[model samples]
Target: MTLKDRIQEALKGALKRRQSVEVSTLRLLLSEIRYAEIAQQKPADDSKVLDVITKEAKRRRESIDAFRKGNRGDLVAQEEAELAVLMSYLPKQASREEVVTAARQAIEAVGAKGQADKGKVMAQLMPQLKGKADGKEVSDVVSELLATR
Candidate 1:
């Protein structure tokens, strides 16, 4: 079965189990996938499904951050619950060490000598790390590594 199919199945299961967070998250995900398909004029492949899930997960994380800053504990908790449900559909995230190692390789491949070459390194690295690591985390790691170079 495709990732979309798995998500659909999970949505059905969540509905059966009356898991509100999972049910809502899955519904939103399917809705996003449907929109993407409509926009692309074709069914989304697994990678595209993952891209949608990743985008939703990122949105949840950002919402959680904003809610925390606003001192809205209830909103933060709700966003966190949704994020957890979204995360279940994503692949295992890359560890900091893995990101660091890959960043190092990318830097070398791109001949990035220092901070000035950050963009070049990122251009080379992001595709390799796509869906496996958060872009912000990867950027931070690359900046730290470049600073020390």
Candidate 2:
């Protein structure tokens, strides 16, 4: 089955289980996927569905940070719960060590020589790490590695 199919199945399961947070999260995700499909004028493939999920997850992360900064514990908890639900659909994330190791390889492969070549290193690295790692973390790793050279 496709990723979209899996998400739909999960949504059905959540509904049956009466998992409020998960049911809502899955519904929102399906809505987002529909919007993406409308924008593209075609049904989204698995990669497109994954991109929508990733975008939604990032939004939740940002909201969680904002809520925390505002001292809104309730909002933070809600967003965290939502994020957890979204994360379940995404591929396994790369660990920090894995990110660092990939960054090193990318820097070498790109012949990146210092902070000025940060873009080059990232360009070479991100595609390999995309979906498997967070962009912010990967960028930070590349920046740190380049700075030390």
Q: What lDDT score belongs to each candidate, Candidate 1 first?
A: 0.93, 0.92
Model 2 accuracy (lDDT, Cα): 0.92
Question: Model 1 clash pairs?
Answer: none
| Cα distance off (Å), candidate 2, residue 125 | 0.8
- Residue-by-residue lDDT tens digits, candidate 2, 1-149: 99999999999999999999999999999999999999999999999998998899999999999999999999999999999999988899999999999999988898988999998888899888878887888988998899899
Model 1's alpha-carbon lDDT is 0.93
Best-fitting candidate, measured by lDDT? Answer: 1
Number of the top TM-score candidate: 2
lDDT of 2 at 123: 88
**Per-residue lDDT of model 1, residues 68-94, tens digit only:** 999999999999999988888888999
Every model's TM-score: 0.96, 0.97
